[model samples]
Target: MSKTAELLKGAAEGFPDEVVTQATVRHLDLPGGAGRFALITLDNGFDHTKPTTFGPQSLTNLDAAIDQVAAEAEAGEIVGVGLTGKPFIFAVGADLKGVEVLKRREDALTIGIGGHEVFKRLSALPVPTFAYYNGAAMGGGVEVGLHCTYRTVSRSIAAFALPEVFLGLVPGWGGCTLLPNLIGADRAVTVIIENALNQNRMLSGPKVYELGIADAIFEAADFLEQSLVWTSAVLRGEIEVVRQDPDRGEAWDQAVARGRAIADEKVHGAAPAAYRALDIISQVRNGDLREGFAAEDQALADLIMGDELRSGLYAFNLVQRRAKRPVGAPDKSLARKVSKVGIVGAGLMASQLALLFVRRLEVPVVLTDIDQERVDKGVGWVHEQIDMQLLKGRINQDKANRLKAAVTGSLDKAEAFSDADFVIEAVFEEMGVKQQVFAELEAVVPEHAILATNTSSLSVTEMASKLKHPERVVGFHFFNPVAVLPLLEIVRAEQTDDASLATAFSVAKSLKKSAVLVKDAPAFVVNRILTRFMGAVLGAIDEGTPVEVADRALAPLGLPMSPVVLLDLVGPAVAHHVAGTLHKAFPDRFGTSENLGRVVEAGKRTLYVYDSGTPELDPEVAALFKVGDTVLTEEQVRARALEAIAEEIGLMLDEGVVAEAQDIDLCLITGAGWPFHLGGITPYLDREGISERVVGRRFLPVGTAGVPE
Candidate 1:
């Protein structure tokens, strides 16, 4: 294929670099004029047979390659493209390594916008384009399909939707436009918004089509042959053009109507975005696509470029990019296999992490705390879960016992860490205590242990400072209830060796966690940014603003829970601890206030009259805000909360506590109860420019430092 005259060879132009081909589709006119198309393949420039990415030329080469094919094909044609491999992926999506090129702005073209633009150009092609997706189609790779006239999926494809909205932008390309146009608005919005929320909601071919995005599906075994048959049909003009239902997707329209009614009835005095998206869909339903596409395009473009999108996209990207796998001794092949894992603490976090690790990796694990009492409690938890699974018939007793046996509790650290290839210490969030445990483990365990600490707000490097084997200390910062939270920060201290980092990545993979590599800075990634989020809520309280108002104001902004409720779940002590850590590490920037300390001293939990696990904004909370009787109606309170949250998010980015604008959204979505339909906090701010407007009306002016007392 590479030797083809104007086909694959010419596709390499402009790319000038080595490329990864993730998609391949070829069309042919048979002897009797029977058009034929065959397997689309995906292949990397590098041999993962060895541990490396594409050769120096990079993924840009593949983009250049595909661009060439699109150029040759007429408008809307599923441009013919192929890779070295067959029947899997024709080409993988954007080479994230391209981010390296993006960082040095003056050195090369801006990566994100440039890649976005490329996808848009592909979308303009007029012929019926079909991507026979075999494997994964992520980021840029999926963007290409947005341009295509059609999409077919092989059962092998682990379909997903993403725009890195949590990374500080929406799908900057036309994806935001194309998706809503392809699917109906509600489903597309759900896909994009949920991608920002969890990042792990896997959508398959039938699912994608059910969501109204995909065009067809084929068998994985015969996917190569089927893809070609479909492509040949395109060449022969036998397939129907992709078209929307005349009712403009009424099924989706009805769902939206039903959802809106539910939202209004159950979640009163809530923000309107979720309902608004449905409204927008309903409005667009009566119109032709031209009107709908234009509206969605401009709205999405403006939204992605907004504060919420920027903050959210940045934060999400940051969280996902850090895959700190433990590849010790540099042998590469068998770096961080994490065959068996050991948990040092079986408290809630420890138990949570244990369940998640087992759920993710299906690997055997040993969970231990200081005493049999706590151990029994933790083991009891596993038993309860296993029993539930047994009752649910999700697993039989034999399997239940196997899984139950897979998780055991103990008081012996030496025994736990000995056979275990990796260990994570999720003890209390104290540096000295973590160090003491590591020291003890080092004395009793094997020399090649990969020690991980699940301290959210502590410094990874500082934690390593007290260790004899400093290189082994890595921060495996997991959010509360590790079983539930998806993001894992792999904090890399200055002393952290590549081997240790690789081990963390290995463990993360075994545990099926999204491991992001972060510098050993204050709060690592998620908490550093989240600390600012909590502070914003507190800041609103300090400015004589009512807590009830602050809480309700953000309700409509699409957060899962209000800021106060989130704080209670986080535990005021832990929240304060992380705040103090970030403040101490980067004083002036992450500085804390008497307000936070006062909360701790005054014995105030996040909200008043806590309603057990999930906090409800009760009367006591209203009293805390001085809302006498009905001073401010629920509607008024929610409006103010939105304003206060926007202000503090702005402060975080300005203060540099959050390195990327999207980091705010990532933290909010994962840790801070961010609502998916509302896309995350930063996106809301950006879409409305509410940040700018809020500051103008209520907040201190942009350049001004503090709010008026």
Candidate 2:
């Protein structure tokens, strides 16, 4: 046995639930009578839902299959070797369940080296190797193809990516070395760094071919047969494949520099994975694949043994598992079918909701406003958005027509909502206005219909307080730009029944959103936490701190946007309103910013101007601030902000705002776009000792989001 195989002998000891992927080999005659071929199919025994992953046992299986093919090639029995996956899934990557059980650096190093040793044999074989990416391929799946001499991808494959950096690890299994050598450094940086940081953006099949990663692309229906024929043609000298020489000059240095800038902007140097991958890619300009492989192995081991990777893995599990099966949600069987929907208020928010509902539920939706002009504008906006989708090829013409026709607008509430099963109001944030809307909606809609409110900060319980059928009222709060953000805070009022809440969850699932169950508190979960955080920065600015210093205080935490940018995105008026609401509820912890109110009063939508391609504080907005004599440094600002957050989270936990800390983290991650490296703030607080110092305890136990004690 090889050193790698020996090292991995007992690596699967603790992974009991790992679904071991198997590699089976078969012999097939070349389509054009070129020669015999050795074809290997990767399967995990389950359906496509259970994608093939590389674990210790799975890697061992593949290693054995490679040995068989290598021997056949040496014996001149097979002219070429081919690798493919089962059904709709090519492979996702390593089994994270296996990675989670690794306890020592040696084990982590062993896994990385074992993968390199096994996959390297494909390129070393005497016969030419081919990879048939028949379906979704990611991480190690993509790396395996990079080891082959040629690759063919199916046009129908939905996702392809090297997402290791996003998960707090480098693409260590020959990816960082082989990909840049195959496709040059610039494209490698895009697939390895830029795309990974952009929420792990995926590449289409055509994109893979366009990037020079694949030699050819074929339709999914007969992808295997066509790939076999193409391979036969290549072997018979009937088809010639040529590749452009990789650029190893100044362009390589420029690409690596761009990758560093992206990593700094995205993670603010808080995570080390992106920099590590960049280093490996930069060293590839010397054309020593072995040196690059060694760098990858060391980097992988270091990251695997660090807290950031563990925290990232924890966050990944939370998003993949907990977000799907939300805690405290009512039974799915209790949900009522929403056949017809009604939306109150004909504004931007309501129009977005109309489009989302009509597209996801495929049900007739009506929007009502007090004036015909507003109603016509709202309906026209929805139609325009549908046309845009059609133009982008996201939806067929028939589907776009159906969606546009399904959404209608009317001036009469009764005509719009008399038979509707679900009616959500996107009216003013005032409690009285929302209560009046719900009261009117209850009188018009069916008795079994649900009355939902999209109020961001108003009390859901108070909104339903004036309704006769309070049991049918629930809070269905969606983040801004409804089509983009995935979070939907499903708030349960004091009088909300199980049926209403269950139906809300069902609708959120249909919208492909991550729903977190929150109580009807002052500002719910995300807005409340964010208000406290932003309030700290604003308070610093009020005390004479520079706007630039206050805004960049939390740079070390790697938040998606700076505080000032976030304030601009959330709108000064909206932030002022929410802050006022929170201050009223908890005056000591949540402060109302006078400067923010001034900005809103001045009708300023943003605090910054960007005519120079970079954000600069707007002079008019800056001149409006009323400051005190005392100023705070950036560290002081960041500390105060985090301390305030820890305190507010403790209070929220005491008040049962959500079930636990994980729910708060989930809310911030999906709703506010917080970085995963911090595990949504609580873990960062715990690791930094802020949670214990401010909250008198840690939010999570040791080893949950930190190093094991």
Candidate 3:
């Protein structure tokens, strides 16, 4: 047996039951006696929910299929070859689950080379090759199409991307090499690097066609038939496909440098995949396919064996598996149906809530405020947002009209919430104000109606304690920019009954959010840990740590946003309130900062502002801070902040605020924008030894976060 086959066989033995995307070959008769074409369909026998992925076994199968097509071409039995995917899905990329079984660098290198070997044959085939992308094609999947001679994409294709860089791995299987050669180096950098870093944004079918990635785009109703006809015509010399030659000039080098700078600013060079990807794109034009494949193999092997890749896999699994099945959530079957939703205090947050509810639930959402003017303004805001969606082509005019009509506003709470099955109050954070709102709501709301509060840090139990129907009230906390953030903390008060808790979770699901069942505690989950971490940073600043120094200290942690950056995004006033609440709850662990209050009072949106495109300390805000002689290094700042997080997470676990450490990790990942490459906060805490020092043990089992078993 060949050495590559031997390595693949060894790898395959370790992943026996991994889902293999089998390649099925069939003959397609060309129109008007043009010729016979061999069509290969890539399917995993799963629905659209399970996207096609290539593992060692799947790659081996595909290699055999390619061999068969090549043999048929040599024998003059087929004129051309075609490759496509199942309905509504081309392929997602490599099977990340298969990476979990690889324990050696040699195995990783072997698998990477094996994929390149199989895909390279597509381009080297004796006959023309075409890729019919019926739906989403991503990562390795996109690479597969690039290997084909001509490509046809369905207009219904929802996603297409090279997202390996986002998951701590570069496009290893011929992607780094072939992409730049097909598309210009500058455009390649945008697709493979910039888009991946920008939350994995994908290209639409029209965008792909516009970029010269696809030769033809057909409607979904006749996508397959039209693609087949187009392929036949191209094979018969009836149509021409032209591509612009890539430029390998100074502009290419400049584009690559720009991508590197973005990576540096975004991750502070903590993630190696981004750098490796830029390196590959920079050198793509310098080498042949063989050399490029070898480079990618080396990069993949090294990354596969790195702790960052393992951490990424852990995080991916946590999101793919654990987040979907919430740890402490009660039976979903007990959830009640919500036909109507009511929002109190129709301000920005409340208007956002009404928009989300009406659009997602397709139900009536009524907003009530203190007076007619406020209510009218809030309702008008919702309408304007819907109109913006219509203008952006996100929704049709009819859908926009329907959404606008579903959202109504009134000055009277009793009239607005009388028929609301689920009513949520986004009122003042004060206990008295929330309690009064709930009391009044309970008086008019139906007996079965559920009352929820959108408080970030207030005590849900205290607010419900004053109400006669306390059992019906639940804490439904949503982060700022409610439409974008995915987390919905469903806080269960002591008096909250199963029905109300289940309904709150149900409403969260209906709104397409990840719901974490949290106990009613001060600053429930994300805000609690965030408050503690920011408090430590603020304390260090008060003691003489420079603002930039403190902010840059956590750069190595690879958080999505920095401390001061987050503080700016989340208004300092809100942060101050949450800090005070946490200090009131756990005085020893959390300290209320007088500097925070002063900054809020001064109306400073951020401690730092942009000066000529560079971040500098705002002179007015800097004057408010009392810088001292004693200074801490970046290491000291990071340690102080992490220690605070560890201590607070320990207290939260001890108080049963969340069921386990993973929930806290999930909350931070989803709500606070923690970098997934760090495998959430707890694992990073464990890796830094702070979890052991402060919490006495690791948050997860030793090996769960890439530590040796």
Per TM-score, the best of the predicted structures is 2
Q: How close is every model to the real structure, measured as TM-score?
A: 0.60, 0.98, 0.97
- Show model 2 residue runs off by greater than 4 Å: 13-17
lDDT of each: 0.57, 0.91, 0.85
Clashing pairs in 3: none
Give per-residue lDDT, candidate 2, residue 547: 92
Q: List the residue pairs that clash in candidate 2.
A: none
Ranking by TM-score: 2, 3, 1
RMSD of every candidate to native, in Å, equals 9.6, 1.3, 1.6
Tell me which of candidates 1 and 2 scores higher on lDDT.
2
Scored by lDDT, model 1 comes in at 0.57
lDDT against true structure, model 2: 0.91
Give the range where candidate 1 is weakest over 10 consecutive residues by summed lDDT. Answer: 700-709
Q: Better model by lDDT, 1 or 3?
A: 3
Writing each residue's lDDT as its tens digit, candidate 1 over 205-234 gives 667656656666777788756766666666
Q: Any idea what lDDT model 3 has?
A: 0.85
After the best TM-score superposition of candidate 3, give how far the Cα of residue 285 lies from its true spot, in angstroms: 2.5
Of 1 and 2, the candidate ahead on TM-score is 2
